[model samples]
Target: MKSATQDKRVFTEQETSHYIGMSRSFLRQSRMEGLRKNRTQAPPFIKIGRAVRYLKEDLDQWLDSHRKMHQLPHEGGAHV
Candidate 1:
């Protein structure tokens, strides 16, 4: 069986928030902030008429782009 996320190529704001583990308000705020800054602060999205949609591929890429493989050293110089 396919998950709901896997079944859709595009998602609404609410579905996108659930899929990406972010709050709807945060996503909305990001878009607004991005617009003010003339840059994107959130995952790429599509705007159709008065609706917004996020592509599954863009979401996956966005998550991957934020990946951190190396751990930063602590201020105390301890691994923990």
Candidate 2:
């Protein structure tokens, strides 16, 4: 048996942003863009009525899916 505090893994928008080193706007834009493009790599979030939350596992998977290889110096200009 776990306490409510111990079982809680869902993160608020701000917390998620802080954890991922992104802004809330960045997360929101990513989510919206994914939906518009029908992409599955977007961070999966839960909407409980008007309240939104993100699961740690989902965020982690999303980060993993977006991983990229290192580029040589001046290989390419950073985008986003």
Full-model lDDT for every candidate: 0.87, 0.76
Tens-digit per-residue lDDT, 16-71, candidate 1: 99988999998999987775555447889999999999999999999888788997
Q: What is the total number of backbone clashes in candidate 2? A: 0
Write down the TM-score for model 1: 0.79
RMSD vs true structure, all candidates? 3.0, 7.0
- TM-score for candidate 2, residues paired by index: 0.64
List residue ranges in candidate 1 displaced over 4 A.
35-40, 74-80
Candidate 2 residue pairs that clash: none
Inter-residue clash pairs, candidate 1: none
TM-scores for all candidates: the values are: 0.79, 0.64
**Model 2 residue 44 CA deviation in Å:** 0.9
